[model samples]
Target: MTVILLRHGVSTSNVAHTLAGRSAGIDLTDRGREQAQALVQRLGSLPIEHIVCSPLLRCQRTVAPLADKLGIDVEPDERLLEVDYGDWTGRPLGELISEPLWKVVQRHASAAVFPGGEGLAQVQFRVVSALREHDAALARKHGGEVLWVACTHGDIIKSVIADAYGMHLDLFQRIVVEPASISVVRYTPTAPFVWRVNDTGSDLSTLAPPRDPAARSGPVPGGETGNTVSTDNEGVEHPDSHTE
Candidate 1:
């Protein structure tokens, strides 16, 4: 199963350089709306079977265009919500940087907990758990390779990517998930493959499943001479193949 993590478009809080956290009413900027609409063209043709997003208005707005285009309902998942900045909610980033805890958040995020919010490690756990649950459910329902989207915040996307790479939560800051970008992860029974990260623009047609079922097989040991898609026992595609 393939899960595409999409960060919400630029928000008013983003323009103000503030942490919106779980606050209500933060919306996308005009340019953000344009970015949201562009997703219709970027992902509309893909074989996306389901769409899930953060309950926040920003994420909801981001995936709205694409969901409408694909005629799919958008399901909001709380686990996909932005990090709970708690007391830091709506505070300026510059101001937050001056605090002592800021250093811990940057260099030792696994142990860094917001004054009244959740820890970065907690954020990673919830989001990753949600993703695995959804992936398993979708794979069973589709009974084969499946593609889906999860529209969320930048930090949330970064955390997921870090987990996919088997990196420590403290190093998640090194992964940049820009506003409205898309990162892809293919989950297999054995491991997860990080196909693309923070991809803002590129052709995505290659993500579609091959037309022939026979084309879905594990990669060649030495190298792949042609396109191949690997499938597991349950019919879920594994990222073991090398496409040329």
Candidate 2:
């Protein structure tokens, strides 16, 4: 199965270079809406069976277009919410960069906690757990492989990438998830494979038309540690073939 991660479109605060965090009332700019619509064109061909999104208004708005087009109701998952910037919420990014905590966030995120909110480690744990649990259930429910979209924030997406790479939490900052970008991950029973990261544009048709079950020799259903199916010698393109 594949989990495609999408960062929310640019919000009003994004243009102002401010950290919107959990702030209320921040909606996507007109360009953001355009980007959301463009996303529909980018992924319209894929057989997306499930959609998940963060509770934040920006993420909700970002996924609205695709969900409507696919006739799929987006399930709001709080675990995908933007990092709670706490007192730093609504502050300009330029200003926050001067703060001491900013350095900690960049160099030692696992040890950095929001002044009055959650820690990066905590965010990573819940978000990754939510994704794993949801992925397994969706694969089973759909019978065999599945394709799903997760509309979330940049930091949240980066955290998941870091986890899949088995990198320490502090190193997550090295990964970049641009607004309106798409990243992908495929989990077999053995290990997780990152197919793409922060891809803003590309043809996604390569993912279409599910593979024939008779051709695959790997584990049947899906689980965290399912056996890896090797399709190399047969020249078969894995649905989760695209990678970073």
Candidate with best lDDT:
1
Best candidate (score: TM-score): 1
Residue-level lDDT tens digits of model 2 in 1-244: 7899998887888777788888888899898898899889988778999999998899999999999999999999988888887888888777888889988998999998989878999999999999999999997898778889999988889899999988999898888777788888877687777767877777666444247643233334553223332211122111110011
Candidate lDDT (C-alpha), each: 0.81, 0.79
The Cα RMSD in angstroms, rounded to one decimal, for candidate 1 relative to the true structure is 8.2
lDDT of 2: 0.79
The C-alpha TM-scores of every prediction are 0.88, 0.86
Local error of candidate 2 at residue 88 (angstroms): 0.9
Summing lDDT over every window of 10 consecutive residues in candidate 1, give the lowest-scoring window. 235-244
166-192: candidate 1 lDDT, tens digit per residue: 999888778767777789887777788
Clashing residue pair totals per candidate (backbone < 3 A): 0, 5
